[model samples]
Target: MKQARSFDELRALSGNWLSREALPAWIENGYDQRLELFHERLSFSAQPLSDLPRRLMVQCRQLYVLAQLTCRGMRDDRALIAQTWESVKRYFYRPALSHRWAFSIDPDGDVADPRCDTYTLAFLLFTLAWLYRVQPNQDYLDRVDEVLTLLDGPLAASSHGLIDAVPRPDGFLRQNPHMHLLEAFLELHESTGRADYLDRACALHALFSSRMLWRAQEALPELHDDDWQPARPDDNWYEPGHHFEWVWLLRRLSKATGIDVDQDVRLLLSRAIAEGIDAEGFAIERVGIHNQSAWNSRRLWGTCEYLKACAAEAEAAPSESEAWRSRANSALAAIHDHFLQTAYHGLWNDRLDADGSRLSADVPASSLYHLVLAIMECERVFGRVVPPSRPEPGRMRALFLDRDGVINVDTGYPRKPADITFVEGAMEAIQQAQTYGYRVVVVSNQSAIARAYATEAEVMQLHSWMAKQLEAQGAVVDAWYHCPFHHEAQNPVYLHPDHFDRKPNPGMILRAAQDLNIDLTRSQMIGDNPSDVEAARRAGVSGHLFTGGNLALFAREVLMPRPISEASK
Candidate 1:
């Protein structure tokens, strides 16, 4: 397969492959008619028709995939997702156990494993969160609250932050469940905007950093003792896949909670790529503390995790973004060549031997969730689709201006509000833009905060003062965005070499589009720097250079329609 040269190409290729080819094949071959849900496995010769005990994790995972598809503009799956949810409610949820979900259910609709598993519960919450996002229902929210209550009460172990697998000490502990718990909390917070969910997620992140992650070796041990320590310190086992997974999760957490985990994320990705990946670009399953191969087999899901880690690293490290993007493309190529070479379109080899022979004969439905997530990350990083809480559809235009030179004089490091002075005719330009039905906004790069020359509070104060000054002249400034990041920043907290929100990254502009409901294609950005223009280009918007002189004249000339030849001239 040919490699993708740009993010747009990558997004188009990935999205189309999933939506047009892979997903349809899954729906056609993965569904079990008698069970009224997805089949556990589909062998090349025959489909399993027997009603066997299926894990609740599988059911929830399938439901989550269908719900995500529906949320992403595939409206045809809504009915199917709803029906699957009904099956989950009927078979998986045990009303006798305080409405706790069973671990697995038999063919006769009996609870095969009545034990309440923390990992299974996390997936249930995650599915419910996505279902609630697609179709807002009070019932789902109530169930979420009830599940949280049970998890905190009856299922809670003596350990402060740990939940039991079977409401008793089975001498088992794993960080996998906590990882999914964090994912669920973040999804809940996204759908509901609940501070409590964010608080819970923060706690899980703390657990990961302190207990789960072995900082000395830069590894995340899979098995843990009851006290949350590694089961065997001398011969510890780690999965490169888990490290890759944590890399992406930590980046998400840092963005959501304002925590700085860049150093840790970098370390994890670097080590995972260096030691976990084979020479053939496949991600191996398990390794020891000394980087010895424990399980030499490569799994499909492991490759997916490696791809996602590369995507996340690309976004975080701009200087090396191309290298990371290339790595992602290489992983994708490996998946296509080794896993998807079967006669069936969507049927992928789940595992491969060390020499690259297929180990599994049947296709499992659980792997779809992993592939979908990796594709979704590609879509998000490439700006193919807006975020889940997208702006309402409209044709509203906006005028984005840079503050330092466009709005005010380019006085370097203006810390005090008293030193602020508006450029000539800048106030008139703002009023005129509003008169022409355009939202006026300011987007600036403030490395001063990173350099410790000014505090964020001081910058906000200056913006407020500037807004007040504009209000006196019957003008308005709709919103303000600034980046306080620099690679060589003096302040440790603000030093980010590849900060996504910095100029030339387009994060602030994209965020403004989401928050203000601005039509980026119709909007225009005015700045004095080339980086500003590049940022607008990346955001899929038009950018204009402001080379001084009357701001009102520049605004009028740009906003007004002119003849093609005259305008070009």
Candidate 2:
């Protein structure tokens, strides 16, 4: 079917729904203030399903959603995320069961399901990673060590993907939990600069490449045998949503570890796009790969996964970026038309039948994990639909680089593509900074706008192009801050004497720190000018004067150093 709305419009609608409607609804009703835990589901009217049993997986997912929002400055739920962390420990965590958390708990906070579910545990770990990223707490770090130790030991192991059920009914080896575990490990690595998490994530990627991937069918097996082979006739199915999810994860892992998994990513994405998505832009819930195509309805979370994969694919396959982007747009439309159209308030329709009917009466809280991350990926690709949040503390640290001499040679206000010349190892330095858990923020002084040589819009356009170029090279400049006003401005509108944002004043650096919640104590600024150093000093950040040579080496040797934890030990 044709796309119901343009990408910008579609994303705007989603963003508005999130900021205006869903956020308040979920925070007010979906979270139990008295109990200090998130509700398992919301009624059709957006009220909490207060009596329902709460799953540990759902609790962790909701907390993760809030943590994502906290990181984005969408909401400062750091206090709530931490408060509920304790609740999770009290309600679900079983210290008696070798410190394994229970699967589900009732409304009264009694254990509903005592199994040490691998899926729930992965989310728990995932939540911890995100929480720690928002604010580095030693407690969260220690907990991560505890969880990893438990997993690496004999208790958390399973034939496939760890143990979903404690009793291990028929020893069902599901691939889904393993996928989440990989995600958790990757995030853990990024959050803490821990090598073991990266190594563990690599191990999971190898598992996917070797056993879980159904190369003959170019698909992933929903269930695998104990021997790591696809479980046949009885389990015979493929979740197309999962194929798309794996595409995103595989590319991410490849970027992090420099592992060559793009081939597998291509294979999985190609098959999923070819057979999984219907003509209506709906991602089929399950494809009966054994010649039995029995799909009853689709899920909103599936389309969310589709959007995420499309974003990743668009980046990886530049030759076909247009097609992948088009698919992503279509996925958003599918989500808007099919799911977000519900008049009542199950955040968005969780499930829809083939004839476009809502299958469920309440919204599952667990889907927030899929939707929040999916929407963020969409924003990253299609540009942010929401407004830029104000700067505040309690955010992550950053590595702020001055643009002119550091990112590109200062050829006196270079505005055009040809005028740009990247400093040595600029890209590698950015990649390294990100790998070591720092947001790469680019702070620059663009006096060209004030001089009337280039318009503000033109300068911004160039910056956008520069950012895209850097991203294409696997070096992401997370945020950009530029001061366009100058005291000697030829244009009266741009004439501002001693503008706060100008480098020597520390305005740009300070604004960026506040906007992104960059911790100045941990952040460092790299630049070639004395003004850059002064600005860094005023902002309470360390400054490094780079006269010449490799920025990558400077970043590694001076900024990063051996301080990054070798968690492998």
Candidate 3:
């Protein structure tokens, strides 16, 4: 397969078929045909509960695949996006609220297990950040900040790495969660420009590059003790997905930092491809570094992530990027051919023999999402580009958002929609930005929710109301992220932990960047408070702090053509 020069060429090549439409070609044409190959074989032996984290992680990956898929075709499917977002949020937020049920049922909160896994938390943070992009909710922003603060308090180490990757109560360590943490932080850093967030991202990048990547074997050490010393190198015991996944992250870091990461990406990706690739064009599931034959069944997620990594490499080093991209495309082509059957178009957890023969199949929804994201990324970067439905001029947007005094009447910790009031010209300012193709993102903080002054539900309702009201005025927010945790509050929810997402923290602004896919280095943040200025500074957003002046006037003045007219030239 040749690399696509444009998205149009990509569309023509793929024949514009959705993965579902393309799956039958995989079944009738490809190899692997075992009935029970993809799904885990049900045996008489009782399944271990400890495997929950791994299972959950897989589920999260699949959800990502679905999101990518659903998001691809719809330019106006707001309802579909909202529903899918709620489904993913159910996994994260439901568990978060589980504590309340424990307190109610036992009256003493004696359930012992909090259902909080480090892997779960890390995954949750990633999802939350993603959700904010699609939905642009402030409550999600607060939740992300809240969750990370909790993790830092319990999982962070003075030695500059997260504690051995364990969920609550055990205090153990693991590589998967740390890797996820690095991924989530990198996302957060890109969304907002807080040095601390970037610093954390760099620190984790260093930790993984220097400490996790096996120097001699050019592989990742699966298990680590509390101090991060490798407990084992046996690949069978760990999934191969992480290695491929890390390749993508490393490449993303390299791209964001403008640093030469070809060597690192090549080192990791080449090893994965060499060890995992098969004659069938699909990579093997698990392979021992030295054993040469301890491979597990090639699974859907491993292949999808490997392709994702390849795509990332393609993006990072375009010159030689095609080699990896070709391998990934081949792997995905093989997967679609062999794994998918006529009954289902999604992924199957079919077990494959070492020779790439399928033994069984269980189409898991979780694996579906990663493939969706991988394909989506490929499409966005290389797929055909039709003229947009609406033609608009791009603007260097300095989102002149009116906080409390400008958009809504500043009710301290506004608890309800009834309390909301829009300032004059606020809607117009938002309209102006949209007209010019400047993304409109709201960067605000509501410490009142953390202060026990308001409930989470109410805070959510308030945001919902705000969005609805804004939309009513023909203004849409591309993204909105807020910090609810305040330093001082009566309620535990309100009690402020010095979090990075807060106004001064730069979290909300950063989140906007990630969600809107805006170039923060070229964007501006307009707010009313010193904290807002600081938030802009933290997020690397360039803008002016506003006061009781007219935002439209400010925008007009700021947007006026420079004295050096093109006519003069």
TM-score of each: 0.68, 0.73, 0.55
lDDT over C-alpha atoms for residue 555 of model 1: 89
- The sequence of per-residue lDDT tens digits that candidate 2 reaches over residues 31-132 is 998779988888778878899988888887888888777655455687888799899889887787765678888899998888766677788889888888
Residues forming the 10-long window of minimal summed lDDT in candidate 3: 100-109
Whole-model lDDT, candidate 3?
0.55
lDDT comparison, 1 vs 2, better candidate: 2
Clashes of each: 0, 2, 34
Per-residue CA lDDT of candidate 3, range 148-265, in tens? 6756776576555666333334534567777878777776565444456567667777887777666667667665656655565554233466777888787676655655656666
| Candidate 1 weakest ten by summed lDDT | 384-393
- Residue-by-residue lDDT tens digits, candidate 1, 328-391: 8777776766876677666678899989899997888788899888876754453321222222
lDDT of 1 at 293: 54
**Deviation in angstroms for 101 in model 2?**
1.4
> Which lDDT value does model 2 have at 353?
88
Q: Candidate 1 overall Cα lDDT vs. reference? A: 0.76
